[model samples]
Target chain A: MTGTSFIFWIVALLTVGSAAGVVFSKNLIYSAIALLFSLLGVAGLYVFLWADFIAVTQILIYVGGILVLIIFGIMLTHRITNVQLSHSSIQRGVGGVIVLVIFAGLSAMILNAPWHRSPAIEPLETVREIGRMLMINYLLPFEVASILLLAALMGAALLSRKTD
Target chain B: MVDLNTYLIIGAILFSLGMFGVITRRNGVAVLMGVELILNAANVNFVAFARFGGMDLTGHVFSLFVIILAAAEAAVALAIILNIFNNLGTVNIDEANQLKQ
Candidate 1:
């Protein structure tokens, strides 16, 4: 009916559709490409939520950083001459049945929950606010995350070292 | 106008699909992709609740942390997968399990 909802519908469809592509595609390369679109669609949802900064970060870290890393993993692991990158799946029947049950339960809970919601919508200075909070209220976690990043960096390098 | 329920439902779908991918995919990298999807779904729900539940910017900060942690996790996980591929010659989880023999 309105512009935002219309945009929301389009984004939601794009996200879900591309996510399906990621799950169902037999080709690993195609799944990676589909994941790119799905990540972009999610950024669009963040836009609708007025989380402009997070949307940008999602594109940066997810699309720019993580997706590239995944692509490299795919390329490095496989012999890339014919590019016949087949990603085989297993136990589909059991997985499908389990997912369906979980989804049904989640949908029912979401639909029935008497959520106490407040529509106090205001455009946020998300970047500035988050920056200040990181330095002040969340200083401990901020420092910890940085340390974690450092540890992860070193650990990854160590794990991927040449065995020779 | 878009509401909280809408986001929650979408998150549910993404989460379920991600779960299915994780369950059925044998390739290690594909499984990582599924994990990314599940993380994205949680990030969406966090942002939505922050916006609509009167929490202001808390959810943004939380999702930022999630993003940071996800980056770290992906880096480490991919490194492990590459090592697995190097030693085992395949990234299939089912195949790499018989390491004791």
Candidate 2:
């Protein structure tokens, strides 16, 4: 009933709805677009949780980069152009049951868990500290992740090249 | 009562939807999308815990790293899917089941 709760519920609904569309939608393009919406919804939720940096990164990486890649993949792939990209009703029914049961179990676990918030910690604006940590304590992992990304990029190019 | 559990549950739902997509979808690209959804769900949980529970920025920073990794993952996965499509003429998982027989 509070403003925060209201916002959270709305964002949650949008996130869940678009995520379901991403799974269930027949048209690959539509599903990709739906994924964009879902990504946006997650970004908004990040904002609500006071993670402005994460929200921005989510928008930049997911909505901007990854979604574009997905759209291009859909375009490059042959099946996306045709209108018959829909999945069967049987697959939907089975997926629906499996997803629902999993959701129920997870929801129960989350709702039943006694989550205790640490009272001593203050609200920390993490950008500066995270930068410092990335440069200092977590420097190695940070560099390694970047190296991994570079490797992945090379691998992607190699895999996508036309072989003679 | 409107605390971290709500966000965690939402995250769980998103993750499950992604799992369902990965399981049922035929297209390799779509499966990659499912995987992205699952990763985003984990990012949500990371941010939530960073805010309410730990009250430190580590979770947010970790989520940033996760977002980057997801981007790289999507690029690589899509590239692989494109290769599969080029070779097989179809992206259907069932069609690519040469290993099964």
Candidate 3:
């Protein structure tokens, strides 16, 4: 295999393994850590796909921000022991079957689909150009999204306030 | 064959794993993590299609927005989770069935 293919395979394995761990882990903390690995692996995939900006954003927002919040949430909420959080086989079995079925169907569809490609793999200047397009064509949605985020922040603060 | 389908398949697998986590996990925070994974899976497909299909970065731009939205979502969801913890003292989602009435 070429270096790129090898890297892709490695990242893919890491992502898939860590993702599986996130589902299988009983300890919420462990699951959070596994999710961190999975996010990192996805970042690697982003790099492989020539999306440097998105990869860094993935690490920054997901690993740095989201995973920390999740860990903190787990710590704050769970008074039980990690061992006690372990679920029964019934839940796992049912979840596994559903996921596997969905996965199989998706894979079959992807494999069978006729993907038509336009020959423009010259690594378009997406990050630079998209910034321009966001300001020009998608400016309204961009501003709306910021407004939404601000509203979310306000709502969150209100919800988390300690009523003393 | 070294194209969008490969990446799409990877995204699908990740999404499926996320779905599995959401279904099986008892912790609300873990479920949120699963949701993040599902969003990332979609981002992967978007970027892949952007790259191979020559859509002129629209897919990549869409993925950027998706990432930002996911971050905002996680922040807000975690805050809600904290609020729930302060009120209910547990993050186990099954306990949330009290709201089913």
Tell me the tens digit of each residue's lDDT in model 3 across B1-101.
35788799889989998998888777788889789889989999988887787667787778888988987898789888887777777767787666787
Give the interface RMSD values of the models in order.
0.7, 1.9, 1.8
Q: How many angstroms is residue A66 displaced in model 3 relative to the true structure, after the best TM-score fit?
A: 1.4
Clash count in backbone of candidate 3: 0
The residue pairs that clash in candidate 1, if any, are none
Candidate 1 Cα misplacement greater than 4 A, ranges? B99-101
Model 1 docking tier (incorrect/acceptable/medium/high): high
Which sections of candidate 3 miss by over 4 Å?
A: A79-90
- Candidate 1: residue B1 Cα off by (Å): 4.5
Report clashes for each candidate as comma-separated counts.
Answer: 0, 0, 0
Q: For each candidate, what TM-score against the reference? A: 0.97, 0.92, 0.92
DockQ versus reference, model 1: 0.89
DockQ of each: 0.89, 0.71, 0.70
Per-residue lDDT tens digits for candidate 3, residues A73-111, read 766676645555543223888888889999999999998
